[model samples]
Target chain A: MNLPPLVQTFVLHFGEMGSRWGINRTVGQIYALLYLSKEPLNAEDIVERIGVSRSNVSMGLKELQAWNLVRLQHKPGDRRDYFATPDDIWQIVRTLVEERKKREIDPTMTLLREVLMQEPASAEERHAQERMREMHDLFELLTGWYADVQRLDTERLVQLLTLGAKVQKILEMKDRLFLVPGSKKSRRDDAKDK
Target chain B: MNLPPLVQTFVLHFGEMGSRWGINRTVGQIYALLYLSKEPLNAEDIVERIGVSRSNVSMGLKELQAWNLVRLQHKPGDRRDYFATPDDIWQIVRTLVEERKKREIDPTMTLLREVLMQEPASAEERHAQERMREMHDLFELLTGWYADVQRLDTERLVQLLTLGAKVQKILEMKDRLFLVPGSKKSRRDDAKDK
Candidate 1:
């Protein structure tokens, strides 16, 4: 309740967003506090800052830890555990993406694969399989692309994201030069001195 | 309840996934049915297929329509309303992304900007604002990239996605050939015949 004004506003907004997403509002508030803090905060600090019950703070911190959204720390000679968000913002984004894929996309893909394995006994079943195939293919492409992007280091990710649509030129160039491997046009280009 | 076995399995999976995400299971089942069906299905058809009550089917359709996840139709002779998912799977993906951005992302960005405008009266406030800036900038980069990708037609999107990390070469190429304006090294590369 007595957070810095700016931090209070950010925490309140996240609290609202969390409830809208069916997450406990306290979880988001707890995360917002940790994210803005320069130092780790213990459960008592979180409960006092956010005006929540001790039990709620405990539950929220536990949920955040489950999501890999926070790191728990213990100071020397201190009995209480403290929490902090990952220092790098990009690391947070990466974790969110990874968790979403694991929770939502992977399960759907698995279900689609299971149904795709079933033999179509009727015309309707055949049509349903076709639809599932389309869904599965789209997930495959997106997940595959994400997996590739995820492997890149954070610096490389920033470069890739900043490139955005400009990469279209590269795709076009690749098709022209590499698609027709060993074409005369491709040969002339790398030779440059001609 | 009497849907083809494959269709039933697909619908059941979506229902489970929907409930997991706090969406109504019936809504997911209805969508699954329509997504697989070759022809538009009336509300009664959904009720019969999913074994839900008429009112639940009506409400589910309304929910789907609200999310822009389904198309409403009317048979020329029948008075009952009918529904179907958008035909192209990519179009469905685009709609889901747009709706999520509208519901979840846009509001958070607005709130972040609002807090960013507040005058920082203390070091704590300043540090909080700096963290906000990092989150805001990351959102900017992601939204910008997505906006660029969204504008591309499906063909270009597929091409872009299929390129995947291989585009790292292009990023390097861009930095080498196009990043600096009018450098001698770049000039030599572009003026191939010289």
Candidate 2:
């Protein structure tokens, strides 16, 4: 499948971004193609469209599958595997956040636990350890809040995301109800704004 | 120099996360070291500390420098090039956002423009092109907002971040500001809330 110069450019750019984001360049480009595509794409179609090796496309699909960013589809009478993106961008964003938390945040929390058991040899070491503890606690609270948010219906999320800039004001007013521990206040200087 | 176990744990976890965030594992680990370390480190110290090849450290440092996440500091009477991270996490976050916008968003915008210029061969193709236009426009708005947010002082930015979830709410109401094209009220189900 020959791609228009414009679509090809996006594919290429995502490929480069892929490496920066943790996915390989090929995976990034592949995703870009999928995102822009109006229809579900099969692996072979992706292979031809992007001009990469079949095996590479296969590998890329597998990785995308692992990330939960790709949806598998089946068409009647079709033996080949097919994939599509969730229709909602908000859903995509939410999934991205959840997957990142799993792959990135949760593991870091586990590492922090291991560090907490170590012996501190000096006053400074103890102070450093305390800082580490604070960071760990904060992250734990953050991870919990993320999980809570994820469980909310999609409508609630869009309600939250659209909040955009005013989110600070509500927090300042204590918004009364949304004030969970980690959710309570920011450690940054803006906390003074409230 | 011996690292306390907590810092060491963070280093290892960040190294793992590097692959996920689009950075190399070693590069992530090196940055983790720099972030946690109180002193600037030379390439040799990084290589020795991380047990990576000196050349790899050099390459990673070069990339970090390009991202503006790492800085060079020369010690008195020391000929070696040493590097360190910004003391503020928000600074690091802001820099990351800026770099990602430049490297990822800017190029994608270029591609979207190219796609818009292409002549659609069929009505179906036209429909797909229309969707692409919407996606492109949304990205353009998002990138512009990021640029605006970047210009805000650290204190203001913190205020925005500290507002956390509420910021998302305000962003939802942004369309009320004017008769902007895509900025028009979203038909999304959650559009009416806060």
What is the overall TM-score of model 1 with all chains considered together? 0.90
User: Which pairs, if any, clash in model 1?
Assistant: none
Highest lDDT model number: 1
User: All models, DockQ values?
Assistant: 0.43, 0.28
Residue-level error in angstroms, candidate 2, position B59:
3.3
What C-alpha lDDT does candidate 1 achieve relative to the native structure?
A: 0.84
- What does candidate 1's lDDT look like per residue over B36-125, in tens digits? 999999988888889989999989888888889999888889898878898999999999998888888899999998888889999999
Docking class of 1: acceptable
Candidate 2: interface RMSD in Å?
4.8
Candidate topping DockQ? 1
What is each predicted model's overall lDDT from 0 to 1? 0.84, 0.72
Task: Give one digit per residue, the lDDT tens place, for model 2 in B32-104.
Answer: 8887676788999888778889899999999999999999999999899999987766677678878877886
Residue A108's lDDT in candidate 1: 92
